[model samples]
Target: MEKEDLKLLQQKVTKLRAEGKYKETIEACYHLLKSGKECNDFKSILTAHINHAASYYCIGDTEEAFNSIEAYVEVCSRFGDEADLLHQYNVLFLLYEYNKDFAKAKATLENCIGLGKKLEKYNIVSNGYSNISHVLMEEGNYGAALEAGQKGLEASKLHKPASPILELRVKLNIAKAYLELNHFHASKALINEMIHDPILESFIREKSQCYHLQGSWYRKQKIFKEAFDSLTVAKELVESYRDLYLLKSIQEERCQLCEQMEDVQLGYRVQKEYISLLNEINKQELALTALKLEIKHSMSDFKRKANTDFLTGIFNRSYLETTSKEWLEQASVKDENIVCILFDIDNFKIINDQYGHLFGDEVIKQVSNACSKTMKENELFARYGGDEFVVLVRGASLESGKKRAEEMRGIIGNVKIEMGGNSVSITSSMGVTDNLDGKVRSFQELFHHADLGLYEAKKSGKNNVCVKLADKE
Candidate 1:
């Protein structure tokens, strides 16, 4: 293949892997390897091997993944890019960590950091420090993790354009280290700082880490309710992002929480769920190997269904929770505003009781459609629950959020669903909040305030929009 063609093909493999089509990605990589070999394209061939290894790892084929990585290393040793070598070493670190080879993982990360500094790739150096911290933490060396985390933070600051995500990640690792060391006050202070950080909100994986650490801190303090809530949010985020590795840790924490609460049945149920989730993840990974060899099933539908709500044909709560954080983070960095609007159908239960669920479903569909129509560009509308819907307006001011909420309320209130030769109209109550200034408030805090406003709206009268501002703290 030509050079441009080879580049496009490489991108295709990457895209496929990113989309979670591991089988398809592996197949593409195989084809690329064959083509590269025929064309004597050593670069393409080496890249194919690396891509194949990543895809294999994703599907739980550890042996093949390791073999491919080895092959990639050999190629890099002969004629590889310095940056590519750095990346491969990082990947090797993960592989070693997965196999419980903490010593090797730590060494590999150190090598990565050295190479990155030599090459002036400060980002890589920063990331290497972060990875080392994580490995050390896994090895039950909190002091070392804290040391590495601080180094990572300092290294990250050396870059021309600071990476908020990386900075937050290092801080979170340090916070975890603090928590593990039983430095409760120190950890709590750091956690509070990050929880309200707009920059941290963008990175869901790191945000989840923050929450997990917060849960740990709360648990240590004997604050059971706060601990459970934080852990639950962490669980939700990991599940949404499909971070199986992190999910396992969260599950273990939850099991502990259940035990501490003395809820044997709940503990049993949590343990069962953990097992089921693990099995499901393993099954999917194994299936990818089968798919590469035998089946060619498409996963697009499965992905769509996972992120979509069946009833309203809109984004589900999981999608909202995951994506909205990213949007908020971006808006924060740009010094723009993000408006969150929470609304639900008024007297939805009564409608269901009187008109039956079928009619109630129609009402929901109609209201959802109306609300969706009122959304502007870059806005997200999601079915929060049975009758609750949330609209996220990116780059919008507090006033704009309230205006949008009123517009949506009008749209929903005017919506009429024809049911059994009867015209039934329903109204909606809405709450709006925005992050305009630098005043820090977490997504949970924003949501809580909006919910309170919604309650106030409902109390005064339904079919109205209420505005709430973030407290100046």
Candidate 2:
């Protein structure tokens, strides 16, 4: 087939799949595969195999789905990119999970995490950890699930511009784990934190989960009225969203709540509703299964793109500013040290004038890479503006912050990018400040102090570091 024809066929298959026409998608993929094979087009064949698997899975043809996925994986191993491999692992994990093959699902998630870390795909890493937590939770290993949930949250922070939904998911998992462990205070604290987040109102599924968990928390405390109200809201949300799986879970919870309240009539009514919902879900499972898989895949991509900076692959100014305030509040409550560092490329305009914008872009990438290499797990680095960057270090003292800033300066200074026939060197000046007096500094105050330190560094020399302490009063 010609390139344009092949492109058109691919688009047709995609559209059919999105429209829930699984049978038609399968037929189109097979035809495309056959045509491409006649012309020895391995790339097109690989694409067909992947789509074929997804279509088969949606239609409940597990045997054929497995065969298609096997072929897809084999081709991916030979010619696919990291993203391709990540997708394959996710599909495999979901397949195993649906089949109740917990061991295989866990193993696949672990492998996915390894590859995600190797490629610096922090979003994939976070998903892998979250999936692992889910599996552990299902297996009734609350302790392990709690640990995995925490790890997932940590990995999520490594992603640029950190996704709010992803963070909420991890926190919900942790709260569930805590509930199982009878840590009511901890679980309640986490749930209450998200209950009023305006963002939750838009995410129907997440909001349902939040209310469900809140219901569970109330049940544990024997607050029957509150539990009933929360669970009712959760059920309504799930029904409105048409989330059959979550709806089933919510109905079961309602039945349990009714039984605990000694409302036999209500319990019986809920039980019947639950059974009816389960039967309907099973009837439509094949069709909904495929749609769910596609939604999961698209959501991951959407969240990553929404939270990522296209140029530097690091956090942007908005993310830094918003997240830093939350971190500051938490640190203040705990009386822990929180440090901020502001820095910018020294003589950046001269470099741009001498080397052109393209070369200047290369310099920015190289410098960002160098700084990223020096970052600790708890530190956040972001591109504040054209040439300036900011770093937030939690649990760091004034002296330690200064030391880290100096180390970053040294690493950035030694970075050399080869341009044409010349080796161009880059250096940065840094200003460091810390809030250690148990005072909660506003974002503006923190930035102002850090900027003052940067000014002192620039005054002393172009490539140096300076530290400014918070006001003692």
Best model per TM-score: 1
Q: What digit string (tens of lDDT, one per residue) describes model 2 on residues 1-473? A: 79778878878887898887876787688777766766677667777887877777766667767898899888888888877888788878878988889999999999999999999888888888888989999999999999999999998888887688878888889889999999998999999998888889889888988999999899889998799899999999888968787788788778878888999988888888999998889878755676656744654565455445667888887678778889888877888888999999999999999989988888888889889988889999998888899999988888888999989998998998898888878889999898764485677788888999999999998799988876765
Instruction: State every prediction's TM-score relative to the real structure.
Output: 0.58, 0.57
Report the Cα lDDT for residue 45, model 1: 81
Instruction: Give the clashing residue pairs of candidate 2, or none.
Output: none
TM-score for candidate 1, residues paired by index: 0.58
Show pairs that collide, candidate 1: none
* Backbone clashes in model 2: 0
Model 1 alpha-carbon drift over 4 Å, by segment: 263-473
lDDT of 1 by residue, 316-394 (tens): 9878887877776666677777888999999999999998998888888888887777667879888989999888877
Off-target runs (Cα >4 Å) in candidate 2 are: 268-272, 275-279, 282-473
